[model samples]
Structures are given as structure tokens and as C-alpha cells.
Target: MEMVVLENEPEVLMENISNKDNRDTSAAPGLKLYRCVAVSFGLLCILQIALNISLRPPLNHTNCISNSEDMTTNLTEERDELKRKLDDLKSHQNVLKSERDELKRTLNDFAHRSNNGWLYFSHSFYYISPIKKTWHDSRNDCLQREADLVIINSKEEQEFIQRWVKNLMWIGLSKRDGIWKWVDGTRLTQSLWCAGEPNNHKDSGEECGEIRGCGHDHGWNDEKCSNSNFWICEKKMAL
Candidate 1:
């Protein structure tokens, strides 16, 4: 009976082993398929990470380049605008200067026309009166006109004045305290007195100076302040 039981045990064990192998064989394909799917998913994740890494630098570089180009364009546009404004300002300044010059010319023309009988000579304005007056009255009239009696500073000036005078004319020279002086309180340095004149007649004292005749070396004469004569007025030009 023992020999028979042992034999039956071997047969049962063999059958159990064969059943396990059959079950393993049946499940192998499904297990391998699951493993392959997992491995493929891992490989796809790695590839996506690598692709993102590779494209990141180019994208960043492109953005940086675009920003730099935009900044440069903005700066260029601003510079052009500033330059245009500067040009406009310069043009406006030129126009203002031209208008100012035109206004000055108009004023000068008006002055020349309004102030008749005033002639420009040697950087001075001169006026010769057609009527006669005493030396004092003539000086007062010159003062009223913002001028003074002509003060001959040079031989050329004396000659220039003579060309405009037809008769005796009271000048700016006068005898004060027995000393010859100009209207501006300057002592006489040179004189053009006529020969044998300025005797200061005892009866009619000659205290004022006069330009006697034209085209003569000595054309000046001393006369009484009360005497009437045409006079010349002088006004210097503005500096």
C-alpha cells in the first residue's frame, strides 16, 4: 500500500507543476505588452524634455534680438524728431532777425523823412536854419531841437560847415571870464580867427564866436552876443 501511495503522490505533483507552467505561458504576452507600454511612455517624456531644452535658447535669443531692434528704432525716431525741432527753431530765429532788420530800416527811413533839413556828416547830424536869430536865441533853439551850436573840431569839419553857410553863423565858441571856451566847457586849443579881428570893440564888446566867410584860411570872427545871424546845430550820432 505504501508503494502505491508514493507512486500516486509523484503523479499528483507532476500534474500540479504542469498546471503552473500552462498558466505562466498564457499570461506572458500581456505582461510583456504592459512593460513595453511603460518603457515607450518614459522614452516619449525624455524626448519631449530634450526638445524643449534645445528650442529654449533660440527663442530667448530671438526675443532679445527683437527687443534690441525695437529700442534702436525708438532712439532713431526720437533723434530725428529732435533734429527737426532744432531746424524749425533755427528757421524761426532767422525769420525774426530778418523782421527786426526790416523794422530798423523802416524806422530809419521814417526818421530821415520826418526830420527834414537834418543832414548826416562825419557821424553827426547838422541842421542849418534859414532864419536868423541872436546868439543866445540860436543856442536856445538848438537846445530845443536836442542839439547844440556847431563846435568845429577839425579844419575839415570847419570847411564842411562853411559849404552849407551863406553868411555869418554863430558857433559854439564864446569868451568866458576872458578865456576862450567851447559850449561844452573845453578850453580852446586851436583857432581859425580872421586876421586883425577879435579886437573886442570897446563900445560893442564881442563875446561870441562866429564863422565869417567861406573858403578862407581865417574865417572865424568874434561878435557881440546880441547880433542876429543864421546858426548851425550839431548832434552826434548814437554810439
Candidate 2:
């Protein structure tokens, strides 16, 4: 019985050892599979990181594109503003040039008037004849010179003539049908008659107008058309 027990114990020990070896082999295969899986996971993580790094530049480029667009828009607006300013300056320069040309024309006209034996006053030219003659002869002389007898149209003109004339002078006024009228056929609108004058003092048929001087009233007086007196001639400025 002792021998049989010993043999059985030895067999049991050998069987246990074999079973442990089989378990160890199975565990080894499982560990190898786990290592392969871990390595694959690590490679996937590295790939994802590399992909993220490579894509970042595109996002930055998008921002740069937006910034470039903004700068281009600003430059376009500035260019438009400069163009407008240049147009305005050109307009102002044109106006100034026109004004200068007008002034030059005016100066030229004054010089021409001065050269033509005419004195400029109140936008008109005047000439004091050096000789005395009858009213009709004086009017004829003025016509030959392309002028006419002076016609006083304003108080200022009358006063100016009063100061300018050295003696009595014949004007372009005359009486027709007892009504005073200018040579141009306009009726008299103002009067510079002296007090108590125009009495037709002798019924001598006073028909011509004269600026009375010779140390007298220096006012308007009617006289016979045949009377002799110095005269003033007037002409309009050339356009």
C-alpha cells in the first residue's frame, strides 16, 4: 500500500507542473497582443498630433487674407478722397484764372480810354472842347468826334461838372413845345435850376440848356440855341 501511495503522489506532482506550463504559454500570447495594441494606439496619437500641427498654418493664412482685404479697402477709400480734393483744387484754379483775366480786360479798357483824349468818370468818358462855338456848331463838332454834348443824369454828375467846368458850357438839353428834353429824346427827370430862373427873361426864346458859370450860380439855365459857349463832349466806353 505504501508503494502505491508513493507512485500516485509522483504522478499528481507531474500533472500539476504540466498544467502550470500550459497557463504560462497562454499568458505570453495575451501579453504580446496587448503590446501590439499599445504600439498601434501610440502611432495613432502621433499621427493626430502631426495633422493638427500641419493644419494650423492654414488658419493663420485665413486671418492674413482677412487683414489684407481690410488694408486694400482702406487704400481704395484714400485714393478716392485724394481724387476728389484734386478736382476741387482744379475748379478753384479755374475761377481764379477767370477773375485775373477780367481784371486785365478792365485795365486795358481804362488805358484805351485815356489814350483817346477822354477822361473817365462814372464809367463814361468826357472831353472838354478847347474852343467856343454856337450850340449847333458845338453839337456838330461832337458828332464828328463820334460823341455828343454832355448829358447830366445824376446829382453827382451835375456836381462833378460844376467843379470841372471853368466857364459856362452847353449841354445836350433843349426845350421843345415848352417841355425840357435830353438830346437822346428822353424827358428831363431832375432839375438843377437856380432860384427864380427860367423866367424866359425877355421872351428871347430860350431853347438850349447851359451850365451857368463865369462866377455865377453854376446851375442849369435855358438860353437861345444861337448863343455861343464852351461845350463838353461825352462818349460811352467801348465794350
Candidate 3:
């Protein structure tokens, strides 16, 4: 049917050819040639549109699958990275567990100690401001507790007693003639005095020694031994 129609349009085709011939050599094509070119482009457009309509479903599916694969690949890489970090953290946890176990074992090695008349850190001292019963009373009190007047020898020994013995106590660091001596035969290393310090009221009848430093009996000064004071004794036990 289409071929029969094309054959019947033979005069129209001859008219188109005649219009192309009338176009000048140096000028653009005539209207009839332009119309023919336009009709050919329209047919090409129609064919392309038909092909796209037929293939739309399958082509869309292919694109969707490609995009899904790319996303899955990215997620897989991220998951692998997370797994590696989890493994590293587990190893660190194991190390900490071992260290904690070792510390617990070490703590078990020591035993607890008990306190008795053996004289723990608890003790007190008394001092005589007036010429009370002579220096004799001070010496006797020190002996009764298995301790002597506080003698500050080394910093270590001084620190040990000073921690708790806050009250004024008779210290062995007394001036003999004019020289300071500790009952333990050790000399005082560091000495502290009060604001108007160590006036040595001994000449005013103050004898023996009294504690005059800032912290307490731990820091001592020369006073008359005739002054009475209580003494401290220190003894330790092993665990």
C-alpha cells in the first residue's frame, strides 16, 4: 500500500527537483530541498525514539545493578577496616588483663601486722616549763617508755618521729657546756628557731632543752635540763 502511494506522488517529487535546480550556484539551497532535508531528520528522530522505548526496562536495570555493585564494594572495604580495629583492641585488652593479674599476685605477698604494748605510732611527751623536779624527772620518764629524750640525729630518724609527735618533748639535743649533742651521739643537721629564738634562757635559770621550731618538739632547742618533759619511744615490727 505504501509503495502504491509513493508512485502516485510522482508529480510532487518532480516539482521538488525543479525547485532545487532554480537555486543559485553561490547561494543557499531552495525551500523545496530544505523541506526534504527536514523530513529526513524527522524520520531519524522517530526511529531513535522507538528504539529507546523498547529497551528502557533492561537498560535501566543494568545501570541500577552497576551502581549497587559499586556501593557494595565500598561497604565491604569499610567493614574490613572496622574488623581490623576490633582485633587490635582485643589484643590490648588481653595485655591489660595480664598486667592486672600480676599486680594482684604481688599484693598477696605481704602479711598484716598487729599493735601491742610494743609501742606503735601512738605515744606522748611532757615538758616542764618551771624547774620541776630537776632534769632527773625528765630522764626517768624517757627511760620508763624504753625511749630517751627525742634525739634528732639523721633526717630519716627525725622525720620518723616528727610525723605524729606534735607536743613539746624533751629532746636529747641539749647544749653540753656550749656544744649541742644528741643523746644518740649524733649531731643535729637542720635546726629551726622561733621568732626571737634560742635566747638560751638557761642563763636565766632555764636549763636542759625545749622544742622551739615551727612544727613542734621535732625541732628542738637548748633549754635547761632541769625542765621536765615526757619522752617518746619508737619500735617497729616486720610484716
Candidate 4:
């Protein structure tokens, strides 16, 4: 009986060892599966973080786009305003050109006419008479042509007349009631007289004035109102 009991105890011990080995093997497989699932979840978390960083724009980049749009709008407005100003300038230039052409045409017509031999100079027109007459008659002739005797108002005008007068010529100056005055009712402020002139020779007999010939300084000389001489007529050009 002792021998039989010993044999049974040894079998039971071997069976228990085998069952423990099986339990350990099953637990090892389950632990391996749980580790694989944890690794996959960690990898997914890293990938999601990388995607978020790549997709979002930086703060400065967004501001740069907005500034560029504003600058483009401002430049377009400035360009349009400059174009308008350029168009206005061109229109004014055209008007000035037209006025210049009209003035040139009027001057050309005056140069060719025969009535009293009109001559253009210094923005004024002059008529040189071929026929000689007394001072009063010369003035009356100018009035008939809707003009007046040439009044020498500046040194330039005096020099211009000196070139045209081949002989003594009547002018618009006269001494009235012992006072020198122009035919246009203006007092004389400048004098273009010869030496010792305006003496009213013989006490007021020489009242009218005349541009002397080339022999005497080419200056003015007091003469009798009835003295015969050539004359010059002045009138503004008809615009």
C-alpha cells in the first residue's frame, strides 16, 4: 500500500506543473496584443500633431496678404487721377494752339492790304501816307480812316518811327493854351525833342509837333499847325 500511494503522488505533481505552464503561455499572448495596440495609438497621436502644424498659416503671413491687397487698391486710384490731369493739360494746349493760329492769320492780312499802307509793329498797326498835307489836314485824314495820328509813347516807338520817316512828319503832340498834351487827352511825361525845342517860337505860334528828318537828331520839333508834312496814323489791329 505504501508503494501504491507513492506512485499516485508523483503523477499528481506532474499534472499540476503542466497546467501552470499552459496558463503562463495564454497570459503571454494577451500581453503581446495589448502592447501592439498601445504602440499604434501613440503613432496616430504624433501624425495628427504634424498635420495640424503644416495646415495652419503663420500670423505674419496672413497680415502680409491683407497689406498687399490694400496697396494695390491705392496704386490704382493714383494712376486714374494722373490720367485725368494729363487729359486736361492736353485740352488746354489745343486751345492755345488755335489762338496762336488765328493771330498769325490776322497779321498776314494786315501785311498785304493797300489802304494807307498798313504796317504791323509792336502789337499795333501804322499807316504811312504817300501824300503830304498840313498837320490839321493829316489829323483829319487819320480820323476818316478810323485812326489817330501816331503818338510816340516810348523810346522804342520813337526809334521805330524814325526808320519810316524819310522827311519831316506830323505827330500827335501839340501845345494847347500853353500846356503840352497828346491828342488822346493824356499829359506828356516823356520828351523826345530836339535841342531848345518847345520854345513856342514867336510866343505860341509853333503849337503842333513834327518828327524832323535825318539831319537834326531825328527828334521832334515844334512847328506851325498849318505847316505841310507827311503823317503817320496808328490804330489797333482788328482782332
| CA lDDT scores, all candidates in order | 0.86, 0.84, 0.58, 0.85
lDDT, candidate 4, at 82: 97
- Select the stronger candidate by lDDT from 3 and 4: 4
lDDT sort, best first: 1, 4, 2, 3
Best by lDDT: 1
Candidate 4 Cα outliers beyond 4 Å, as residue runs: 1-116, 214-216
Model 3 CA deviation exceeding 4 Å by range: 1-135, 144-146, 186-189, 212-218, 234-239
The lDDT of model 2 is 0.84
> C-alpha displacement of 217 in model 2, angstroms?
5.0
Instruction: Give the lDDT of residue 86 in candidate 3.
Output: 99
Per residue, candidate 2 scores C-alpha lDDT tens digits across 1-239 of 35434658878999999999999997998999999999999999999999999877555778899999999999999999999999999999999999899889877866875897777778778888888899989998988877898889988887777767856789998899989998889999888876766767799988898888534558888888898899998876643
lDDT of 4 by residue, 6-116 (tens): 668878999999999999998998999999999999999999999999888767977899999999999999999999999999999999999999889877667554344
Please write out the lDDT profile of model 1 over residues 66-167, one tens digit for every residue.
Answer: 999999999999999999999999999999999899878766854873479787778788889899999999999999887899888999898788778857
**Model 2 spans with C-alpha error above 4 angstroms:** 1-112, 214-217
CA RMSD per model (angstroms): 11.4, 10.5, 17.5, 9.1
